[model samples]
Target: MSARISNNLRSAKAVAAALSDSEDERLSENSNDGSVFLVSNDEDSEIEKVKGEDVITEYEDDDEFDLETEPASKQRRLNKGADRQSCRGSRSSGNPNFSTNTKNDDMDVETPVEAFRVLFDDAILDKIIIHTNEEIERVMCLLISKEHQCQSIHKKIDKEELCAYLGLCFYSAYFKENESCVKDMWDDVFGRGIYRATLSGKRFEFLNRVLRFDDKNTRSERRATDKLAPIREIWDIFIQNCTNNFEPANNCTIDEQHKPEIIMSYNCYKGATDTFGEKSHEFSTARRTARWPLRFFYNMLDQSAVNARVAYNLNADNPRLSRKKFLKKLAFGLVEPHLRRRLGIATIRASIKKIIRKLLEIDEHVPAVVSVIKENTRSKCHLCDSNAVGRTRMKCPNCLRRMCDDHRTAICVECSAAN
Candidate 1:
């Protein structure tokens, strides 16, 4: 029995020796691969320490791992200080020149209308008229039936009508009535009478429907590279005008509350923007529309009004001049040039002519002859059939343009004497 127990013990010792050899071989292989296994007397404690050190080393080696030993609050303070230093350095070395660069002279802004023209002048109006007429032509071409091409559609939009349309737009914004329906605003009883007086509801709707800043035919090609292709041309003109007329102060801030500067040079002018926001909200011309380009156009109109007011106030220096009054004058001024041209039209109603003369402050005067035309020579009447009328002997003495008897105005001696 003693001999059998010794044999079993020998077999157990051989198995234990085999396991120890395998463990040593694995450790030796690990060491060969540049792995260091520390030897310590306290095996369990040393194993735990090595495991902890391995985890720390892996974390440190990771590219994305941030080694922030400091508290979060302390770290944030350090970052803020660094940002402030950079901002201060940039601002100190930047451009120092800042002054008003008004393109208009004092004499040019003698009247409210004149002052308003400093920004939205005749050139802008001409461009709008051209584009509006082009849009009308496009719509006309699209109409398949004669019934679809109404008389209004056949008649091209002129500068006078465009001015009236813009005047109504401005009026709507000024009264904060843009939210109101067009029919409601034009209502005889509850509605403001100014809208109806300025333009017929249908005409106003038609103009609004066709109003465009750019040609639609070329927009696709332009839009490939320019996202703002729709309003780019007019927007460029407006930007250029603003740049020429106004200049920012030395300490101008873009967005103060959200984007603060390191060293705020001017705090007093800070409230100027806030004040403008509040006032512009009160007189905002923005109308909700699905078309982004149309919405952008509305914003442009609103900005134009505000800029005109600024230009007027700067030049006029009239403390008593209210925005409401200035806008009224500005609208009239826009319509004035067109109204003057309409005065020469023979088909215009007597009542309308009288109103135009009154608005223009024109005194009745006798027509004089500058020169006599050759008896044999005949010219078409300026007011008749788009210059297709039968030649006439009559001509305007002021402009020396040919006209018919119906186109001539006859004034009483007393009226002419008064002038």
Candidate 2:
């Protein structure tokens, strides 16, 4: 019984040996195939061994592998040597031709408003004005009730008022009062007086409500395919302006995650955006509204203010300008032209006239002395009705034209009070 058991154990050992020899032979035969088996080894040795195996498999069917009978290590060394020699041959000392054609840097931009205008020019303003007026008219047409019609009787916004509205928006941002209630902002006791002086609270609220970037009638059609249909036209214009005005450096990268601190400091793109968000949040002109377009408009204004600062700083010759002062100047500059236009109306108060003149740097018109000419030389008043033929010896010194007493009196009042 012991001999039989010993014989079975010996047979089992022989069968295992035979199976091991067959596996080794199969592995050797399939070695040329592109199959890799991982084995336990030192980290560096494993890496090198895998790399060596990869190189051998890649060139297995090549003429180079057929001609070379070297060991795997010798082959790897030869490949490394060849790679080094190829790199040396391909290396060049010549510098790459890279240049920036940024128009903002080359521009003669001096003020914050001028820089702001680079992004939001008259064309954009005109577009806003047109759309805003269209929106107002549309709302007015929809008002069938007498009470609603009376409430909607506000005049359509013009270029000047639009500018003033934008200026006020910037002013709100500068003062960090955007989130404040309109009543609080316009309060005589605690509010900044400029808000009241620049625009009526009701007028501002009306402008904000009707301010449109695009035509509402056509928006639905465009919205079917465009996610940004509401502000697409304005956004396109802004993007084109940015592309024309600014050019990024070649070394700039836009990676938001795992960025090196040094790279973040050098690249203004991310820094500017972050600063814009921070500063805008501190003084955002956006109110909590259901309309996303208005929020986007507020964001555009914020970005414009930030971009304007960068543009303003491009000129080193300018005085050190703070953001508040910069925004004040920018806002005033935008509203000044419209204010001057309003001065032409006769109904404006004398005190308001003097203020407007001072702000516009206009030399007040001197009161023209009415001089009498010889009766023979007197002609019909230039401003009088042709049928009336009111001949006057009195002549307006400013226009150097003959005027009747009625026209002359009106001119005298305007000239005297303009100062």
Candidate 3:
């Protein structure tokens, strides 16, 4: 480059450095309204330029003159800690200047990972530097808002939005130890969304008794293997269905309306863990106590807890866990030891029916039930109960008899299609 042009760029760079400080002052000085902060050797000219109708447009074309994309010169003293002192100059540090120590701390503690933590923090700082104290507090609260634990806490945002934010945190911190901690605390306090997030995180340790590749050790290994299959199968269904509407980029924003059963399952899993401690025995006891399917006791406990959580909105309840203790006992059966031997199929079915009824309130299993009900109510011919509904002849495919719509294989479309 020519020396004159280079010199001009150097001079511009120097002015830019000075302008950073001026920028903050300008932002503060015009706090109620916004004004552009311009840097130029001719102050009057720059001010006049800013006032012109096409000022931003004129400057837009000359972005190379802007400081951001420009190449740094040897004369520039940009380094750590430069922005700390200046009122308006650019902060020398990059976004996420959080120290290595902070990264390690976040990792160890399972703090949530946000997509734009650095950007968000920077924006908050910028707002603070410019806004009134009240606005600063309001913006900070928005940035750090968490899911409501109780009604007395004065809600400012919807629960689903809160869940999405929490989900973002969980999703961002995937595979981190702190993620597990966050999941645990979230489950303990909030419940429903945590199970879905945990299961999605695929950090099996966060899921109580739902054994994964890592949990296979000693007797615990065999037990976890035995307990894990059904839960895993259920999760496979849950994930496939729940994720149908969510692309990876937008996974955090699950609507409360979609995949109700999956949501129920997530809540149930969370509730079970909260009721039962993280250890295997507590899970085992809770499973038996809840009177869930004993063969897959641990799996049922995990799934059930999630269901209960989502269904009840336990996190937002006035008195959290009030129903938890009773539900656990009722589901598991705190009947005297002698009563266990005398318990019949009817009793077991009744317990299951009760759980199912409660689950319906949350509508978590509505999708699954609706799918089943639709399959059950399809049109079919009547001559024999073995014909496909749409067939022109209306003859039974299996029985080969003439049939009408009324009795043509009451088995319905799903069964016929399966055949």
lDDT of all predictions, in order shown? Answer: 0.62, 0.66, 0.32
lDDT of 2 by residue, 381-412 (tens): 88887799567887776677887788855435
Clashes of 1: 0
Models 1 onward score TM values of: 0.55, 0.57, 0.17
**Which portions of model 1 show Cα errors greater than 4 Å?**
1-108, 144-147, 255-269, 316-320, 335-419
Best by TM-score: 2
TM-score-based ranking, best first?
2, 1, 3
lDDT of 3 by residue, 108-193 (tens): 21111121121123333232223223333443465467642323122232222222332333232222222234345345345433
Whole-model alpha-carbon lDDT for candidate 3: 0.32
- Report RMSD for candidate 1: 21.0
The better-scoring model by TM-score among 2 and 3 is 2
